[model samples]
Target: MHVGVLGAGIVGLATAWQLSRRGFQVSVVDRAEPGSGASGGNGAQLSYSYVQPLADPSIWKQLPKLLLSPSSPLKLRPQLDPLQWRWGLAFLAACNARTSRQTTAQLLTLAAESRAAFEAMLAALEPDCDFSATGKLVLYGSASSLEAAGRQLELQRAMGSEQRLVTPEECIAIEPALAAYRRQIAGAIHTPSECAADCLKLCVALEGALRARGVRFLLDCEVQGFDRHHGRDGRVRAVLTSAGDLEADAFVMALGTASHRLGRRLGAYLPVYPLKGYSITVDVDPASEGAPHVSVTDSARKVVFARIGSRLRVAGMAELVGHDASIPATRIETLAAATRAVFPQASRMAALHPWTGMRPATPTGVPIIGRLPRAPRNMLFNTGHGALGFTLAFGSAERVAAQLAS
Candidate 1:
C-alpha cells in the first residue's frame, strides 16, 4: 500500500516513517521545507510525565489578567471570524476539573508510548540531534498553585507518571543554573524521566532517514485538495497538489493549523486552531557559564528554557490571533526578557534568533488522532497537538499507521 502524508513537520515525518516501517510505500507532502512550522523553534522540552492540559479551571480566575494585562503570557485578540468565537466557547467549556484530568490521562498514556517509540528509533537510527534525558522542573510561584499542582501530580501518579514535588533548594540541586532564580520559586514538580531535544534537527534527520528508506518526499508541493471516490466509506485516492495529483492508497492529514481549512474541503470539521507563539534561540556557553543542562518551565511566566546544543531554546506565550505568522518585535522582546530574568547567564540577550509560528491547538488539549466516522475510511488525521507536537508525534503516528494497517 502507498500512503501520502500531508505536512512536513514532525508529525508528518513521523507518520511517514511509521508507514514505511510497516512496509507501505510512503510519500510526504509539504508546502515548505520540513520543520518550517511550529517544530522549528518550539520549547525543546519533551514533557512526557508533565503533560498538563492548557484548558484548566484555573483559567477562569486568570481571565482578567489574560485579557487586560499587557505582559500576560496568554493573549486573545478577538477576530471577526466566527471560528475564533466558536473555538473560544468550546475552550471555555473544556475548562473544568473533570475535562482537564480526562485529557491529561489520555495524553500521559500517549506520551509514555511516544517516549518508548522515540527511543527505539533513536537506537536504530543513531541520529545526533542533541537529545538529552535531563529532567524537567516546573517551578510554581505561589504556594496555593504549588499545592494545586501537587494534587494534579497525585492524579498523574495514579496514571503511571513518576513525579515529585520539590522545594526550591532541591530544584537548585537538580539544575544548579536555577540557583539564581530560586528566590522566585515557591515550589516545583520534578519529573526525572523527562527529556529534551533539538526538534528541528530531529525533524531534518527523520526526513533524511525516511528518504533513505525509500519514503518519497514531495517538498515545495502545495496540497490544494483531495481527489476522493464516492460513498460513505470512500477513500481519498490522491492528493491534488501544485506539483501534480500524487496518488496513494491511504492519506493522512498532519497539516497543523492548515489542517482545518483543508479538512473542511473534505467535509471534515477539524477543531484545530492556530495559537500563535514566539520563541528566541540564543547562543549559549554551557561550560563557561550557568547554562542549564536540564529543561525548566516557569509556570508563572508560561515560559520554558531548554539547552539545545550550544543554543538556548526559550519559548512561550500563546496568542489567539488567527493565522498571522509575522514575528512581532515586542513579542520577541518579551521572550528574550523572560529568558534574561530566568537564566541571566544562560545566553547573550542581544543575540537572539526570533521566530514565530502558528501552533495548531484543540480546545481540550487532546490531539485528534485516527479516523473520524464522518471522514473517508482511508483518510486519517493527526492534528491539534497544540504545543505538544514533538512530544506526541511518534505515538500518534503509530496510532495512525495502525488504523491504515488494519
Candidate 2:
C-alpha cells in the first residue's frame, strides 16, 4: 500500500515514518525542504505539563488590553475577512472555564503520549537532535499569576505530571542565570522531567531516516487539486500537483495553515488559522557567562528560552494577522529585550538570527487529528497544532497510522 502524505513538515514526516513502519510505501510532498515551516527553530520545549488552551477565560479579560497595549504578548490585527471573524468568534466561545478545562485535559493526554513516543524514537534512532533533559522553569512576573500557576500544579499532578511550585529565590537556585533578574521574578513552576531539543535537527534526522527506509520525498511539488473516485466510499483517486498527478492508496493532510484552504475546497469546515510567531537564535558563551542550562518560560512575556547547544533559542508572541510571514521589527526587538532583561550575560544578542512562521491553530488550541468524512474515506488530517507542533508530532502520527490501519 502506497500512502501520499502532503506537507513535508515535522508532522508529515513523522506520519510518513509511522506509515513506513507499518509496511506501507510512503511518499511525502511539499513545496520546500522539510522543517522549513513551524517545525524549524521552535521554542524547543517538550511541554507535556503545560498543555493549556490559549483561549481561556483570562484571555477574554485581557483581550482588549492585549490588543491596545504596545508591548503586549498577544496581538490581533482585525481584518474584513469573514473567515477571520468566524474563527475569532469560535475562539471567544471557547473561553469559558468548562471548555478550557476540557481542552486542557485532552491536551495533557496527548502531550504525555507524545513524550513517550518521542523518547522511543530517540532511543531507536539515536539521532543528534541536541536532546537534553534539562528540565523547564516557567518564571512568573506577578504574584497573582504565580499564585494561579501554583494552584494549577495540583491539577497537573492529578493528570500524571511531575512539577513543583518554587519561590523566586528557589527559581534562581535551580538556574543561577536567572539571578540577573531576581528582583523581577515573582515565582516559578519547575518541571524536572521536561526536556528541550532542537526541533529542526529532529526533523532533519526524521527525513534522513525516511529516505533510508525507502520513503520517497517529492520536494518543490505544489499540490493543486485532487481527483476523486466515484464509489460507495468516495476516495481521492489522485492528487494533482504541479509536477503531475500522483495516485496513492491513502492520503494524509498535514499541511499547517494551508490545511484550512484545502479542507474548505474539499467541503470540510476546518477552522485552522495562521498565528504568526517570531524567534531569534543567539550564540551564548556557556563557559564564561552564565547561560541557562535549563529551558525557561517567561510567563509575562509569553516567551521561552532554551539552550540548544551553545546557541540560545528564544521564541514567543502570537499575532493574528493572516498568512503574512513578514517579521515585524518591533516584535523581534521586544523579544530580544525581554530575554536580555532576564538573562543579561546569557547571549551577546549582537548576531541574532531572526525567523518568523505561521502556526496553524484551532479555536480550542488542540490539533484536529482524524480521518475526514466518508467522502474522503482514504484521507486523514493531522494539523492545527499551533505552538506545540514539534511537541505533538510523533504522537499525532501514531494516531493517524492507527486510524488508517483500522
Candidate 3:
C-alpha cells in the first residue's frame, strides 16, 4: 500500500514511520521542514504521569481571573468568529469534574502507551535528542491547591500511576535547585518514571531514518485539495498540492490547525483550534547551583523548566486567540520572571532564545485519532493534541496505524 501523509510535524513523522514499518510506500508532504511547528522547542517534559486535562472544575472559577491578570499563564482574546464561540462553549461545557476526570483517565492510558513506544524508539533508533528518565517534580504554591492535588493522587494511584506527594522540604531535598523558592512552596508531587527530551531533535532523527528506509519527503509542498470519488469504500484519487498532484492509496491528515481548513473541503467538521504557547531556551552554566537535573513544574505559575543537555527550557502560557503564533512581549517577560524567581542562577536572561507555536487543541484536550465518518475511507486524522502533542505522538501513531491495517 502507498500512503501519503500530510504535515511533517512530530505526529505526521511518527505516523509515516509506523506506516513504513508496516511495509507501505509513504510520502510525507509539508509546507515547512520537519519539527518547525509545535513539535519544535516545546516544554520538553514527557509528562507520562501528569495526564490531567486543561478543562477542569477549577477552571470555571479561575477563567475570569486568568483573563484579567496581566501576568497570568492563560490568556483569552475574545473572537467574533462563530467557530471560536462554538469552541468556547464546548470548552465551558467540559469544565465539570465528571468530564475532566473522564478525559484524564483516557489521557493517562494513552500517555503510558506513548511512554512505552518512546522507550522502544529510544532503544532501537537511539536518536540524539537528550533522552533521559530524569523524573519530574511539580510544585504547588497554595495550601488549598496542594490539598486538592494530594486528594487527586489517590485517583491517579488507582489508575496505576506511581506518583507521590512530597512536602516542601522533601521537594527541596529531591531537587536542590528549588532551594531558592523552598519558603514559598506549599507542597510538591514527584513522579520517578517521567522522562524529558528535545522534541525537535527526535523529529529530525526520525525524518532521517524514514528517508533511509525509502520514504519520500515533499517539503515546501502545500496541499490545496483532494480529488475524491464517493463510493462504498471512498478513496482519495489524488491530493492536489502546490508542487503537483500526488496520488496514493491512502491519505492521512496530520496538519495540526490547518487540518480543519482541509477537512472542511471534504465536508468534515474538525473541532481543532489553535492554542498559542511560548518558550525560552537558555544555556545553563555547568557551575550554576540553580540548574535542575529533573523536570520541574511550577504549578502556581503554570511554567515548566526542563534541562535538556546544557540548556534550560522555560515554557508555559496558553492563549485561545486563534492561529497567531507570534510571541507576546509581556508573556515572554512573565516566563523570564518566573524562571529567575524559581531557578535564580540557572540561565543568563540576555542570551535566552524565545519561540512560539500554535498547539492544535480540542475542547476536551484529547487528540482526534481516527477516520472521520463523512470523509473518505482512505483519509485518517491525527491532530488536535493541544499541549501534549510531543508526549502523545508515538502512541497516537500506533493507534492510527492499527486502524489503517484493520
Top model number, lDDT: 1
Q: Per-residue CA lDDT of candidate 2, range 68-153, in tens?
A: 87777788878887878899999999998889878888889988888888888888899988888989999898989988786677
Worst 10 residues of 2 by lDDT: 370-379
Question: Which segments of model 1 are wrong by more than 4 Å?
Answer: none
For residue 133, what is the lDDT in candidate 1?
Answer: 89
| Worst 10 contiguous positions by lDDT, candidate 1 | 285-294
Per-residue CA lDDT of candidate 3, range 216-332, in tens?
A: 999999999999876775578899999999999888899999998899888789989888899999888767778999899998888999989888999998888887766778888
Clashing pairs in model 2, backbone N/Cα/C closer than 3 A: none
The estimated TM-scores of all candidates read 0.98, 0.98, 0.98
TM-score, candidate number 1: 0.98
Clashing pairs in 1: none
Error of 1 at 26 (Å): 0.4
How displaced is residue 59 in candidate 3, in Å? 0.8
Over 4 Å off in model 2, which ranges? Answer: none
lDDT of 1 at 399: 92
RMSD (Å) of each candidate, 1 decimal: 1.1, 1.2, 1.1
RMSD of 2: 1.2
